[model samples]
Target: MPNRRIFNSFFLGGFECSSHRRPDGRRLDLLSATGHDRMTDADYRQLSAHGMAAVRDGLRWHLIESAPGHYDWSSFLPMLRSAEALGTQVVWDLCHYGWPDHLDIWSKDFPDHFGRFAAAVARLVRDETGPQAFYCPVNEISYWAWAGAEVGRINPCAVGRAGELKRQLVRSAIAAIEAIRAEDPTARFITAEPLINVVSGSPEPQHIFDAEQYRLSQFEAVDLLTGRIEPGLGGRSDYLDVVGINFYPDNQWYLGGSTIPLGHHAYRPLSEMLEEVQARYGRPILIAETGAEGSARPAWLHYIGAEVRDARARGISVEGICLYPVLDYPGWENERLCQVGLLGEAEGWEKRSVCVRTASELRRQQALFEDVAAPEPATAAE
Candidate 1:
């Protein structure tokens, strides 16, 4: 069992800070679109009002690095100051599927430039916060590779290049970790990847094999980072530090079929999945992202919270559950309102309406988990 606590709160609010460009060539700045950039102080205060003291946020690399080797912290400083002032611990995402337009994703310079940018950001964070910092170096490398390189749905929209893109992302993540550690040796890292299950309804052997292979592919990026398969990428066991799994309702489906409904026999319990992750990595785990839309929010939280308790009771070192996009945001492709947050969309400093049901459930879970002893603070130096 792990003896150290990884976050200030077991329940965390995650800001959707994706800045990826759409396939139509329009860049999406979710922070501004959802008014989070203008309401950082209110956001932190709101999280505190709901019994949360930790958050998962991102640094917009595209906004920060306007020119090669140059950075402007104008866009990120205010949020950092707000979190620090309000005593909210934050896990920062250095690259969240967006980068400066000048850089080519396939170029050898990509990782090197990313390393430099990460080091600069680390230095800023170390100076603003302290020795202890948590960072998800690159968000969802597998998903990014698939969406951007494989399916041509987003920027760097190249078909049939996901393998190349995945390797590049792994390299970039290793570089970021190395650079950040150089700036702040005590900084802890989290690798957030989608937790998925692919089942095959067909009796054909090839179909079954394909489904299993697809399911296992979810671990590719983490494996590459841990040097489990690609030692030449400068990966090491420590680079895989804290395992962050992002789960959602649509995460599981049959090979050529629809989603496996929550209670179906084919639906795997989240506790079972967490056990697999912990057993494989022998490291702390975090539900780095999890949430549902509309009326599903409260029940989803209840279900996830319960499973987390089950995992903990079995001695799995599950650290925390983050309500990703804790505030609703505009959809990535359609620009439709995604009502998936505990708080709804708002303008400027206007107070956002709360999802009363989800907030109440969150409070209830907080009380239930209260009996569990809080562990000592965790650090990379541990």
Candidate 2:
């Protein structure tokens, strides 16, 4: 039987925040309101008691490097200390779709500057939390590139700059990973890229080709990190240890008249996608971020857990599943953080204990993998 450890997974809560000043000259606090005061310690312990193995916390570049060569780790240190004390590991995300405004994104110095900041953070985290803690150098590189450079939705928004921004970000990511590894060779790194599945419209060959191209663009970071880039672009293999897939129900799409038979509420099955990534990358994979809409979370969790079990039965090294945005926060897409968390606002902290049918399904799926037969090798032809 395949080992049962492969199916064990849990949620990691928390979000991004820069330790810089807000427009009104107020220092921004990333912790939720209920977590805002001296009570954050109690909140951290509460999260641990509710089965969170780790918390995906953000350490913004602007915050760390407020001025050239100047840093203030005072604010972030406490959170890390609390997490460690609670026995919850941290997946420290270095950059989350933004950077210090002082640095020009298109300048040659950007990558080198980012690398220095990353190395500093790695040293501090290792010194404080030890070697086993995980690090995500960049969060959603593809999405940030596409959104800021291609779609023009964020700062320095520019349309049709996807290619340029993607290259820059990939280089930055590699540099950061290399810097972190330099500090601690055993440092675990996971690059959390959005797993977007684009289906073609009309079932026409051209549409299919276009959709494939789109999908390839999203997978480019993984390709570059794994040293499988096309001949023209340079590739870096040393950084690609784990592929972190972040998928939401809304992350998939059908273009040009193609219909996803799966309802808007339905999510793409995890087993098939997990197999594809494993077949292509040949490395352990983690569902770095995945969660259902609050109202349907019970059903969503059940379906995802089953999919994970199925992937394991097929011999994929599926590591863990994280329920993202475990606590409600502000400033999400359309300002709807409550929609994604396992707990609804009305339930408050009680949402943590609110187990739905999905919990039972997850338990059942875990049981199935406990004694399953070894899966056949995934052949290229398959």
Candidate 3:
């Protein structure tokens, strides 16, 4: 029954470049050829103006070390300085996806390579910024493994080896955590992972089994991080301080021939997910990422607010809810980046005309949910 504080801010990790690509097929332009143009100071100032107290930003290992023992800090220093100046705490994501193009994902040296890289970043950030910075060794381990290794969605897209990918990801996370902690023992750790709750229309044995396996696969990383898995597989809970859940409305799915509307997916309320994670891991939970894709943001905000309220009433330590990609970008998944931004893209940014209608809607939704009070707990005497 740990007490939790509501963390208010828009999630901005993916927005910053860390040698990763957006859903729109755009790679982050954080660093230039000279590695001189990393995340600018103005970015932090703008985010702080939006009333942001925290930011999820990146510290890429590959960018720091294009080759072994070749460390570079010119690109990342500004990011750390900007966060400090803006008074914004950061959840530093070490590895968002794969390493630099030069390194292979499945190479045997990958884990140790990443470990050294992480240690270097942690030491640099700690020496320069002190020990208060938060760190997430890797972002969405399960999702990356499934999408990259099993589903063939991204680079090195291998298939049918979900277990192998999961194992490697878990080991990588553990190694990264160890490396960071070695430099800064008091650094806070939050492991962000997608929480997929799947539901099928068919009650047939095969369908039910598939649904269960899918859900189980989603939690594989969590189980390993939280020490719930059997030993000998690198499943140790020593570094799992916070369980970060990146949930989306599309997480729940109806199987079979059911014709549920695209927006009517049968997802579990965020509260339910919060409670389950707390019960299982006994750690504070943060909705590391969550948001809807559309102009009807008021309804989306209200729905998510209701879910958070429900969870707070149950004495769950629901720490925060971050709206993913506070701003829209172009070229998302298959060039179909849905309008999932609080603010629409600027006019010249993409070929599609900017949606002016989203401006008022975004303002209204932000106001509605800005100061939402968590539901009060029930009295035992009642």
Candidate 4:
């Protein structure tokens, strides 16, 4: 088994830091909505108690770069400091489906401005926190492409432009990687994208072919980044670093049909999926996002934990599993409370309630993976 000391812990917490504009033009700031922005210190402290010393968080690009060529780290500095103080390792997402309104996504200026912004962020983070850092330059490129261009549900709402938007995002990510490397060559990256399985609802040959094609589309962004396709975008094998897969219960579905229920004949085991990804990329894999709402939370985590163990036993370098949206927040489309986090919604940190069931499950998982995580090397500071 590959017992690499990648993350600080085998499990990770993830704050919902989505900063995207709705199709109707209303901007959503999940960090603020969940009170994480105000309770950064408290949030990190709580995660530490839950054994999540590492976390996935975001930098609100729209807030930081409200104007072109200008960055106001005022929106992000506190969060960075809080993590440093708490000794929390963060995979900072530079762009989580949001960008400055002054820039056009389709224009060449988008990547140009993003590269500069990423370089600036790298310098600041290195100055404050030290040499080692992790970044997800452009989060969920595949999903963002579909949401923004194919479905017209988010920014740059353009129908049938997913291909164009996807390429643009790839270019932007490559540029950001290049610029950040110039600042801190030791920086790591997480290319997070949704992992899905699509099965044909019909036995017809054409239907099966279409379903398979749609399912394979999930790899488009990673392939572009690896220079497997579209080499003109300046992607190289090294550009694709850690493979971050965001899996949800609803990820697998039948083409043109409803979500495929678990245990159904066509339902694929996550371990097998992990194996396929390992075979393809041959890089470290992180379950960068996975969780369920309310009553389903414990069982969902248990399922993923078991699958990850299975993958690891098979020699797949499964690095860690992140419980995304570690705190509950309001829904995107509607403001309904989504009970998907281990920590429940609260007006203040004192009022927050930890989901006992989920927390217990997490502890149980930690115990299971404790032997899998290698001991950390002692730091001079320690």
Per-model RMSD to reference: 1.4, 5.5, 5.9, 2.6
Evaluated at residue 107, the lDDT of candidate 4 is 92
Model 2: worst 10 consecutive residues (lDDT sum)? 373-382
**Model 4 agreement with the true structure over 1-382: per-residue lDDT tens digits:** 9467678887889999888889899999999999888888888888888888899999999889887788899989999999999899999999999888888889988898899999999999999998768999999999999999999998878899999999999999999999998998888898899999999989899999999999999999999999998888888999877899999999999999999988889899999999999999998899999999889999999999999999999999998999998998999999899999988766466446799999999999999999855446412110
TM-scores of all predicted structures: 0.97, 0.83, 0.82, 0.97
Q: Model 2, which residues run further than 4 Å from truth?
A: 4-11, 14-40, 230-234, 256-268, 343-382
Candidate 4, residue 342: the lDDT equals 86
* Predicted structure 3: clash tally: 5
lDDT of 1 by residue, 1-382 (tens): 4445778887889999899998889999988998888898998898888888899998899989888888999999999999999999999999998999889889998999999999999999999988878999999999999999999998788899999999999999999999999999999988899999999999999999999999999999999989999798777888888899999999999998999999999999999999999888998888999999999999999999999999998999888889998999889988899999999956447478899999999999989876542546675733
Cα TM-score of candidate 3: 0.82
Write candidate 2's Cα lDDT for 234-329 as tens digits.
Answer: 566656766789877667777644435444543356688888888888777878887766567667666677787788778888767777755555
Q: Which residue runs does candidate 1 get wrong by more than 4 Å?
A: 1-3, 347-350, 372-375
In candidate 3, list every pair of residues with a backbone clash: 23-332, 23-333, 24-331, 24-332, 201-255
Backbone clashes in candidate 2 total: 2
Better of 2 and 4 by TM-score: 4
